[model samples]
Target chain A: MSSSSQINKRRTKPAEVRIDELMSAAQTLFLEKGVEATTISEIIARAGVAKGTFYHYFESKQHIIEALKKQYIEFFIGVLDNAVRQCAADDWVSQFKVWIATNVQTYLETYPVHDIVFGVHHHERKNSEKNMMLEQLLQILVGGEQAGIWSLGQARLTALLIYCGVHGVADEAIANQLENTADFSEQIALQYLKMLGHGELNK
Target chain B: MSSSSQINKRRTKPAEVRIDELMSAAQTLFLEKGVEATTISEIIARAGVAKGTFYHYFESKQHIIEALKKQYIEFFIGVLDNAVRQCAADDWVSQFKVWIATNVQTYLETYPVHDIVFGVHHHERKNSEKNMMLEQLLQILVGGEQAGIWSLGQARLTALLIYCGVHGVADEAIANQLENTADFSEQIALQYLKMLGHGELNK
Candidate 1:
């Protein structure tokens, strides 16, 4: 109700905007200088935020890295989810193809950020991001199985195989600086469809 | 030779034996305390060697890690190679089965060392070890294709998928601590065989 309090409210940005600014600043610095060489001071300066504001949001460089990781996963899953939803609910084949194609394309576009966020956790044996991604792929696999589009002896195992297979090949594509990801993604989808006992679909 | 030279030669171990002793010591300490917590002094002490002797072989902790990594890959490839050789040369299917099963089993048994040595390079976008392992798997794939056991549209891509898929799943198995790896290994081999367009082999 005070005049000073009213002025502070007008100056302060919303919490979400503030958080996004900090993460964006950190990501840009991480990409440019490598995460190890980047500093909290550099991030806050880039965001044009007070030192207190940076500390209030993130405890350390490592904490912001975790937040960035969570943000990256949400964005990644959202992109894939939106792409998959474009297919009809019962059109599992199309749904899966879109998922594969979108996954490869999105990851290829975003892997520099992905590497920065996920670099330290690369050797972590247990990962929630991996699980979340697997869960997304699993829904498609289970749906196809229920529709009798394909049969699976082990749905989770098969999902793991396809999910991991797709991710692995994408890493190869990225390493090779592959340019024709559209064609490459299609080939991957078809090959995996064959693995799922749907080679007839390809023919 | 002089008397001191004769005594020094008699007192010293062979180069291979000394290198193995140093590497084994470093591996044990790395596994026990983690690579970061371990020190060169500890490695030399564990090997019952003097500081000079340690530096005579390795310049630093990182240097020894590099040596251990090389040693690990050679041992890993050697084990897989030996297992594949046990199968009939013309039996591409069995060669592949053994390769997958042995890859899973050996990686399961030795993953601690594998993680220790390869952990630092986890985020490296390009890797020689990956290529080397892929080359080993590619041989079976190419053999199978030549024999008409199965066909591939992209042999390297297929090989990358299978190699990374098997590795990723094995990592999952390790995280879950699944005990029946023999059955688990068989299942993986069958699934990948299916991926290679030979699912009928399972029946």
Candidate 2:
């Protein structure tokens, strides 16, 4: 083996690390200049990788965007998952409250990335990616139903209302420059809980 | 007076009629073939207007789209206004229900145009047009609160929740090909009414 080849091997990163670095760099650029203004060459330069390395993982700018989308979804869901874990296993009401609060807080803090990933596809008549978030939210609704905390005649629709309401209201809060996410979250949770026939929780 | 000048006077239409013709043609083409596929030439030909006539009214395809967006907002709000008129002034509950129902129904019927105009601009951080819809909804919410029909602590947030939830779920309904919009509308209204501390309305 040549001496230079050995040096290059020592500098090489794991495939997962390389992909993450590329995605991080792309995300920064997308947030800074937006997707339309960003390019593959800039992404490679920021990641300190060869042009071939980018093509090895991502076919084009859109592929990196797809990867960023998946990562955003996972990151969003993970925040809710961790928040829900803080409650007792059978305490569905607390779990639901935590889910709503964490959802608003996380979305408020990370909306630039959220906008970058979700901006272009609002016109799609149907979106399978939305269903992933819906399915996660459905688990909470179903759990509350089974626990006798709430009775849901149409759980999927109910989930859609709550999930969308949470997302939509956060956007409104951001638009209005809302100061206290915690206070706002509590208010939103009370209203949703009221819809679930748990108005007493507002007390 | 020349014979050609007199002949042209009879052939030329008033500005209002010409603008309407162009918009009608654009809406039809946008619905049938999507905004991306439709062309200005096709719009002019369909409207039976000369190229100069088209240019006189709109600067470009995007200009026409902006005009159509204004028309669509007016049409949408007009439907809700008419629906609310069916209820008496003091009957805010019924007014609210009609607002929600008509919003869902009209959106379901007219989503193609909605997607066409709104699809491209969803990423914008602040949209005054969306705020207009929210403002209309806030009147129902605040009116209900003032009339002792319901008590709302955060009326604007509630409006945001209702507006966003309604829009998001309608998108879901269209995606799922929901057949009976009436049943879905009633179910949605019940949940929202309950959130307004009107749980007895569900019975």
Candidate 3:
């Protein structure tokens, strides 16, 4: 690698800084006015970066999306893994409930902007990141089963079911489906936690 | 009203019949030609309906979607109610499993077109039908609680959990998110049944 390239990368104020600024600007503009409406020129203008810098960082909107999606998925996986890590020593079922609750909080907390990540956003927007996170959840469930904590015959399927309610509620929240959003999500998540923890819902 | 109008009303097929025909045509077109690529004219042509007749029966693609959604939710509710009725006298949990397995078959065999119902096509659609069915599920759950058949403290939330998993599996299946579709869903439902039936993952 060139010394100048390494030096610039380490500098973090000029070249590296501009990329972050551009990404933030693009995300803000894209969220405020959808992907179709936002343009590279506008994103560059917002970031106060020259057009060349934008090109240096991202070749096209598609390229920007690729970068953004990678980052977004990485962030999502981190959140889930963090949840998993928090309950590493607990009963698998209890830990599973905690994981589910985190997903709900992830949705409610993310709200309008971050909600897209919670849905069936299998678009180019989400791919490997989602699959990896899903696999991690499966691993948790499988661990539960192997330890005899969870007696599910199908770990993957169980993971899907266990995660399903959380996903649906989150999706509903994302879609603004409930008449009673606050109460409904709380009730839904609580119920799911109970059901997943115990076969019967008692929360 | 004229005699012709009276005759037409009597001779008119159930809105459901036309709706099914429309759905059949639409699904075929949607698969052969993507959802966005397919045109209203193509749908009408496939349905053998006139331009005005299409409007008479439905306002737009969204309207057709509305009708299809109502039917889908109703069908699911009908299945659940039937399951509850059959198992109301038996173990509520077992009955629920049988009902889910039955629906899983139905999902694979019959309504392979449930992607739209699962919130993927939300631009012109609303979540009202989905919630309405949820309310119905809650009613049955309330009955189970009253009779001490089910121990869900918050029935609505509990129902949300079960529904999210099973329904979400079907959603994934319809959304083509799973491999080995048939085995995947039923296995999960049964695992869920065991988990819900007995507190532990074990029987």
Candidate 4:
């Protein structure tokens, strides 16, 4: 074939790359115009993929959002896991602090997608994803309790409080548009640690 | 006029009573069938009021939800206020405890209505109603600080944490289908108090 004809041939990108392109395009559009406003055709157009290719991956626009939601949750939990792993296995204090701090930082950074996914789902009495995150947090609380760093009389309840409390305050921080979330995250960590009767309060 | 004729004369209820009837009926319907499923005609029919009465009180379904939301917030804050008032004026600790206890108690008691009114509102960047409730909690925190029950370095943030933490745990309690929320509420209050460096954790 001539050089020009060769250049015009369809380039076969990997399935993962194409899926990423579609998801990235969908995320951008969803964030820009909202989930309700964006459509599948727009996503396919934005992704520069054929309709068949789009269908090969996601069943619908909502399916893309579901995929994004799963990615977002995994991304968030992964961040916490990495933060916690930075400390020694026995140093549950650091693990707990890093968990809270990373949680605040990552959530503030990623809440737009968070809002897009979670905001649409109404008051779900039972959210498995939330429960999974709580399980991760409980590990930190229970680990600390076992190590004698603090007494967690009600470990699961305490985890729920800390997990929800962190998320709630992060929402507040986002609302106020605080410039430095790290300091606020640290403040939250210390306060929760104090609640756990592990860390000393600031004088 | 004959006695039967006089008794049959259309008994015009007071405006306050009429408005209460309309709101009560609307609340019940909204809870039973959800906001979208409940209709203005049903509300009027349930209230035994003419269509004009509902129109006079609320412009639309959304308008009724707004009214119900305001009433719900007031009812909630009122419960906390009454609980706090039961203690001595100078006893900020009791005031604070009552505030948390009443908050958890009232939230668990009334979350269905709360969800109905609030479930549809998107993740708001700023919620004035939430701010108002936070202000009420701040009073107790600052009051206790002035009384020297415990030092609150970051009183506003502390209040936010405590407020969010309490709500979060109550949600957990509800999710777990706990029969008695009092013990859980007390547990939450004591953990927060420990965070405040005032209450002792269970041994």
- Most lDDT-accurate candidate: 1
Model 1 over residues A104-165: C-alpha lDDT tens digits?
Answer: 99999999999888888766878999889989999999899888787677878888888888
Tell me the DockQ of each model, to 2 decimals.
0.69, 0.64, 0.32, 0.57
Assess candidate 1 and give its TM-score to the true structure.
0.92
For each candidate in turn, the interface RMSD (Å) is 1.4, 1.5, 4.8, 1.7
Alpha carbon lDDT at B160, candidate 4: 80
The 10-residue segment with the lowest total lDDT in model 4 chain A: A1-10
Identify the leading candidate in terms of DockQ: 1
Off by over 4 Å in 3: A1-4, A7-16, A83-98, A116-127, A138-152, A172-203, B1-4, B9-24, B75-91, B110-112, B116-126, B139-147, B171-186, B194-203
For model 4, what is the alpha-carbon lDDT of residue A82? 85
Model 4, span B1-203: residue lDDT tens: 57764564557665667778998999999889988898899999999989998898789989888888998888888888888899998987778778888888788888899898889985885787878888998888888777777768688888888877888877777777777767777777777788887864222
Q: Rank the candidates by TM-score, best first.
A: 1, 2, 4, 3
The predictions' CA RMSDs to the true structure, in order, are 3.4, 4.6, 5.2, 6.1
Residue-level lDDT for B60 in candidate 4: 93
Residue-by-residue lDDT tens digits, candidate 3, B63-179: 766676677777866876676677656465555556566566566554544555444543322456567657765665565456555455555556666666666577557557444
In candidate 4, stretches whose alpha carbon ends up further than 4 angstroms from where it belongs are A1-15, A200-203, B1-14, B200-203
- What's candidate 3's DockQ score? 0.32
Candidate lDDT scores, in order, read: 0.88, 0.86, 0.63, 0.83
TM-score of every model?
0.92, 0.89, 0.74, 0.87
Q: Best candidate, TM-score-wise? A: 1
Candidate 1 local lDDT, residue A95: 94
What 10-residue stretch in candidate 3 chain B is worst by lDDT? B194-203
Error of 2 at B93 (Å): 3.1
